[model samples]
Target chain A: MYTTMSSSTTTTTSPSKPQFRNKLVSSLNDIFVFVGGAILALLLLWSFCSFVSPNSTITFNISSPTRPKPTKLVEPTNSETTPPMNCAQNELAHDPPDHTFYDDPTLTYTIDQKPIKNWDQKRQHWLAHHPSLAQPDRILLITGSQPGPCKSPVGDHLLLRFFKNKVDYCRIHGHDIFYNNALLHPKMTTFWAKLPAVRSAMVAHPEAEWIWWVDSDAAFTDMDFKLPLSRYANHNLIVHGWPNMVYEERSWVSLNAGVFLIRNSQWAMEFIHAWAGMGPQTPNYSQWSKTQKATLPDKLYPEADDQSGLIYLLLEENQKWADKIYLEHEFYFEGYWKEIVGSLRNVSDKYLEMERRSTAGGRG
Target chain B: MYTTMSSSTTTTTSPSKPQFRNKLVSSLNDIFVFVGGAILALLLLWSFCSFVSPNSTITFNISSPTRPKPTKLVEPTNSETTPPMNCAQNELAHDPPDHTFYDDPTLTYTIDQKPIKNWDQKRQHWLAHHPSLAQPDRILLITGSQPGPCKSPVGDHLLLRFFKNKVDYCRIHGHDIFYNNALLHPKMTTFWAKLPAVRSAMVAHPEAEWIWWVDSDAAFTDMDFKLPLSRYANHNLIVHGWPNMVYEERSWVSLNAGVFLIRNSQWAMEFIHAWAGMGPQTPNYSQWSKTQKATLPDKLYPEADDQSGLIYLLLEENQKWADKIYLEHEFYFEGYWKEIVGSLRNVSDKYLEMERRSTAGGRG
Candidate 1:
């Protein structure tokens, strides 16, 4: 319309002889009628073609009250197609129609119990059904304290800040977090409680690749830092450890089980089964403690701890599990608050200086 | 193939004279050939029809490694048609292509400042683009504590449990949560801090209808009970109140301001502006305190509190904001820990008894 109006204006603005202009006007009117009819015919043909072609029929619409947006229906199980708009309003509420491992009535999500088999295949099936949440390095932080109130009056307060810190870190990193105070197994007390919680979380959040167990006592001092998941691509479990220190000190609690990233896999499940065998729930608990104590005697504490059990596993079954277990020695995962608090200022100043340099360079 | 095999088996089983059977078989073969030719032609026609009809071609497939699950490309912004599979692995990473209020140069998410107009329309557009998160009653629990450690030795630990309790409730209810200790606006201290935090949450989560402010000091005693959001459909803001108590006792803190449910609407934005206008940041802060003290003559304390200011607002601006503000007298939003704790065991026991009755009834 704009082009036609501009063309008409151009013809009118240009100077012309009166008789010639009159003749030209009549000719132009006849041509206009003919062109208009032709254009109308072309539009009709285009409309007919569009009616037959479903893909080509979706025209650009903005605030057109006459039409709701174009939509396509999707079967719940088929990740092959997503719901056009509201299909996955229940996105997190997705349970693919085609049965995965959940269909097997025999399958249990319990810890230190029956082991899960063919998890990789089952996980693939799950991923195929829920591609929206199938990122390989997605983490789910699991942390919790005892069910009862803190013995120390100020204990609960400290816990709140620590939990808050974890929540902050998880939110910033787009990771899911679970804080449970329930004791899943009565016998699996203290550190052994992690097993049932981790197992349950694994079954609950198939979308997450790693069930990150950040101990309730620990805190995320540097909120800006994110877990470098890609660095442990080959490994399924990662824990902060100094093996040389373990050898030198000959201490039971060498590796800080306080914070660790364990992959949601069949191997991890098996490792958990082996590790939890040392807990009070098992028949060999006393024997395992004796074995561990004989290896590395400690004067202050004597009961077989979860951390100590893991150390025993690494030392005893080095050939079997060490290949998939990553000892994160380069960075400290957890430390004393007094030790970590002082360096925070330096870290903050360094970050600020880097920011200034980047800003200056950008201005230039 | 199964059908054909069954037909051959039937032919073999049926008794007949050898010579007559042979002639019958030849005759049957001729008839079969003619019918088969017709079927083959029909199959060809059907395949051609399926090729044209896009929707008809998706056949049931199980464990077919030969074909990667069916997939289609998606233009991210167009919720009209979602990507077939991997298109929304970045579902949480959604940013529709259309320009929203966020695109406006002068817009700010800061509290008690520039007001957002046409928020209903803006939220509508956002919901349209993100139908997946467009639940009308979806909640975003906003709670926090002081940035510094609690002065009491066990203060931090108590805060952690309260936060965890909130987390547990939010998780079970399928609601998102945000915990921020950062002072967004410098002068908004103590109770005044909620306004900034609420405003920030409203901007951050356009998906949620209600920015539920549950104070860090409060915890959900009833885990089974969900906020009956449908009950507050007509109201934009809901806070627990005892109007009769306020009238009779004439205390400064008549109603508990520890917990409230405020809807994410333009009305809320305006309410925040009006409410924060009486904060420490404003020149009338002292005057407002004096006004509140005059209204609620309390002997214990005289300083203006957020709860007292709220009471003053209710008394002074009864006609203006009262209609949208629901004073929930039917149930308590918050209460003292000691007051709430005594009834918890009875509540749990009743629930257990009800469950037992239901199970027995089901078996019968």
Candidate 2:
């Protein structure tokens, strides 16, 4: 059976506009004479008065007793418990916070009569505000031809679970292809070379103070990691883990895609745009993976992964544009299976405690 | 001046169906008595009569004086100079002889009363049979932010140089962000992902076979690639590329995302559905910069990226579902810049020669 998605169209009819005809006009000289004499003087005077007068308005909203508010009045039904299926409490079960959030006047939220499970109103709003939201400036992500069993829970599931909710995210599942037989990690950096996700967002949302990129499984000790919408009130790239917190540098220490934010500053957008264009042989990452292995400092490691490739990109191109890169310590943290789980659990515990405390207060 | 992009909000008006009068029909027996005793008996008798009597007619088409014969219609206004820009053209633009085979018909094809600049009606027909042509399934090539760099000769120049007569190939400068990036990719893989042009054709004429996705730069070399439409028939993903070509034993082979054919095949759609899924925390890739060193690869890659991720997933999980993934090597060659550009250039030269020869023949 075909399922119906949301509808966004309506048809309305309106009465035709009234037509008027003017009497025959004089010739060009006569027309000028008509305007140049008393009529022109009166027009000029009227224009000056309209410009100077505070009361002057192009149009007026004339309200009358007969004109009613457009709001649809809700009639009290005879049945107390019964409601339309769309308005049923069952659907609200998924969104109980609506009851709480609605009470918070600060949020200034309007509840949709029908909470569509499929359509994202927030995304819709963002899209409408920035028509470009639907089409991305650039889509940057990692891809592999043959991914291994991936001893690391790093590819799809882990990636999706962590970040899918924070923002608009899509996980493309390419066939199990690897640059180097699942040995080398997904060096999305090379692919990002072509995709311009970062630069695009800045251009698309000028009002957005900052644009952050976070990997799915990256751990956040506190939900405070949510970049304050006002953080870089003025635009600038607020990358963490990068050295000196500058636009360029090999220290690449800035927050990993694991968590990096752009202040939507001119410097950041220009930097990203320049970067997408300048590259060699388009960086045949597939071939490179086959030959090179990852080595941390003194030891050479087999199977360079997503992390290693990132390090390589940051380091190999360090001298050319190192100064622009900035490293943030707050964003730099070790990534591991246990650590991620621990962080998630810690966040969960805090949430539970908050809930418990709130409930107790309510009871008191 | 702002030029509107080629996209329409398909407002699906779900005709509100009256809720059935179920209060009286709660009992199955009562429902059967009401339906079976009257309508069912009459239908049964009618069926028996049709089955028993050879003269009893069932199949019928409305015949009226007002009905215009299909052949009696006037030739399209552009018929002499251009081909129909109908949905069928969109579908045919993606199909076989047009994209894969040696017999080139597109060179002669015209559209909207104008000879297609670089492409022919043959290509249009190819797209008609392949619904996926205009619908970019995996890889999205977005230009700089804003719908038209109507000003930026950068991307436009590149596309024009590559796809000749193909003007609407790249969605445009930053229009990519207008449609939800993740949603569009998923739709491409799922039921909704066909070229809008092709969809229009299907609406105009439903009997077309497939949809083809061939960029202006793409060209047939050996014409050895057998169109996959023959095997899968409807909604099939057909292409020619080196498959099972392992990159260091990872079973890696790159295919041309620009020139792949898709028929309305269940397998093709399932592959797309299987490929599309949104994950949380996909980086706001809109800001990724070439200068930026790779950060976390696994973390940043979002779902619905260029089909590479999906390809990786398919291969990784092949043992679990091998039957669904078919390798259509005959129809698509890897259009990687390094490997195919030379051959493509050679083909372009040949095309020029062919064009000259045709002109000479026409003159003779």
CA lDDT of B34 in candidate 2?
11
**lDDT value for model 1:** 0.54
- Please, what is the whole-model Cα lDDT of each candidate in the order they appear? 0.54, 0.26
Candidate 2: list runs displaced more than 4 Å: A1-163, A167-195, A204-207, A216-225, A228-235, A240-255, A277-326, A331-337, B1-364
Query: What is the TM-score of candidate 1?
Result: 0.61
Task: Give candidate 1's error at residue B38 in angstroms.
Answer: 64
- Give a tens-digit lDDT track for model 2, residues A136-237: 212222211121121222222222212211211111100000011111112222223112334433333332334554332232232111122232344343
Model 1 C-alpha lDDT per residue in residues B1-364, reported as the tens digit of each score? 0011000100110111122211211221101110100010000000000011112122111111111111111112333222232221223324455566655657766775667888878888877876666755777788765555454444454456456656655543456677766566666766677788888777766777899887665555443244556567789988877777666776555666657889999989888888888888788888977787678766244456577767767778878887788776654455543343344445445445544564455322
Q: What lDDT tens digits, residue by residue, belong to model 2 across residues B61-164? A: 11111111111111222222222222211221122322321133332111112222322333344445444333322122211111111122122222221221
* Predicted model with the maximum TM-score: 1
Distance from true location, Cα of B106 in model 2, Å = 70
In order, what DockQ does each candidate have?
Answer: 0.05, 0.01
Cα-based lDDT at residue B93, candidate 2 = 15
